[model samples]
Target: MNATAKQPISMNISALPGATTREMLADQPMRMTISKLNFWYGPKQTLFDVTLGFAANHITAMIGPSGCGKSTLLRTLNRMYEAVSNARLEGEIQLDGQSILTQDVTQLRRRVGMVFQRPNPFPKSIFDNVAYGPRINGHNQPLAEVVESSLRRAALWEEVKDQLHKSAYELSGGQQQRLCIARALAVEPEVLLLDEPCSALDPISTAKIEELLVQLKELCTIVTVTHNMQQAARVSDFTAFLLTGVMVEYNPTPQLFTTPSDPRTEAYITGRFG
Candidate 1:
């Protein structure tokens, strides 16, 4: 298929009321639908009745205060919370209309790749780092090609092409984060979860990662949990605000930043309160 310029998101809030609480800026397809989601760790609940939908080929950012359960909700989507003992999940999370909880864990994980805040590259060479996923998943593609394409998609190939054989640890922090992204992309997942992927990097590195995310959305849906409000404003198409384990508001990025429906959202965005 030929790639044409995608239509720009409508940011015109001129006539719309300032308190536009409704979501669905456009008739975009849903990549994931989360309904009445509740999560608990042993005895305490971290997420309460969080229901939202992530649009395909777009970036949906989860932003809120430190303990607002942004990461908790992100992890719940992929069932990453299952690792904790006594962890429990309630309600439904569907990918492409099929329940994620019902899917095979390995297969589900392959289709829902994730990159964490810290860059956790393997101790092996860069080539091995990117190839690990495909190798484990029995991907039939040529290892060299997969490695190259994934790195190029991540905006890291040109920087690390000559050093593919070098230890992943030898690269700088930013490069390592990009490498982790390349590693995640190697499996060709349909949805990517990024939990503070840029939190540890310098401004230049963060910018690069943000740029890569925008590019990656052409191939996959993106759900990112970011503490940086400015980062959300710059890169996300949709924004979800959580406060005290409750979903306060979810809307288009422009709407959420400019005229949030809830006063709490406005206050949080404007630095009045977290």
Candidate 2:
């Protein structure tokens, strides 16, 4: 999720007071760091003790074959895994510097927002869809400004500027996905997690979202899960290749694609095997 304009540095923890502790530091004024992380759905493990760090103001793409746990790892970043009936997680995900797994999940969700593969806009007007997160989070700003700002950040403002009251479903697939991004941006999360967000869109729509991702990275740390190899190369500064729920390699995008040290990463990127 992207920030509006540029938030004042004064709003930092200095104003919140006593947020100087290690727990508060984990909340991240900047980046997200995951260490020795693992996850499982019931008795079946989906993630290994993965360790990775997503730099602030950059996009890190997670790439792998289906069920390699890319999406599962994305969910764990924000504790979406906790909602499932038998899901469990081990290890820590530190945002900025704080361990989110041990913190209040409700609070964690506010700091980490996610956009899914498919556009799942609410059955509401376009304006309301963008306004939903703020409304739910008890934001009392002037509704018009918040809606406009969020939509602009999502790169959907020009298209929907005239149809704020139209039902969200009225928008095309790409527009709907952008609306979802706007909805997530409404809450001003410190980190934005996208799970194959362009998979359901057309090429044109995918291009638009990719452009939006580049812009959004300027305002928040971004972690995206994608099956598109070109996209990983095009949009990400760093890329991590996973296989069977294990991280094979992680490095700068150029290096990872052109000179991967791990044979598995090279094979996957070169269209050999996933």
Best by lDDT: 1
Backbone clash count, each prediction separately = 0, 4
Range of the 10 consecutive residues with the lowest summed lDDT in candidate 1: 1-10
Tell me the deviation in Å of residue 61 in model 1. 0.3
lDDT of 2 by residue, 213-254 (tens): 999987788999999999999999878888877777766688
Clashing pairs for predicted structure model 1, backbone only:
none
- After superposing candidate 2 on the true structure, give the runs of residues whose Cα lies further than 4 Å from its correct spot: 1-30
lDDT of 1 by residue, 1-274 (tens): 0121111121222333444344254456889988888788888877777778888999999999998889999998788988888999998999999999988888999999999989999999999999999999998889999999999999998999999999999999999999999999999999999999999999999999999999999999999999999999999998998887778777889988997877778999999877
* Residue 194 C-alpha lDDT in model 2: 97
Give the Cα lDDT of each candidate: 0.88, 0.84
The C-alpha stretches of model 1 lying farther than 4 A from their native spots are: 1-26
TM-scores for every candidate against the unseen true structure? 0.91, 0.88
Task: Provide C-alpha RMSD values for all models, in order.
Answer: 8.2, 10.2
| Best-fitting candidate, scored by TM-score | 1
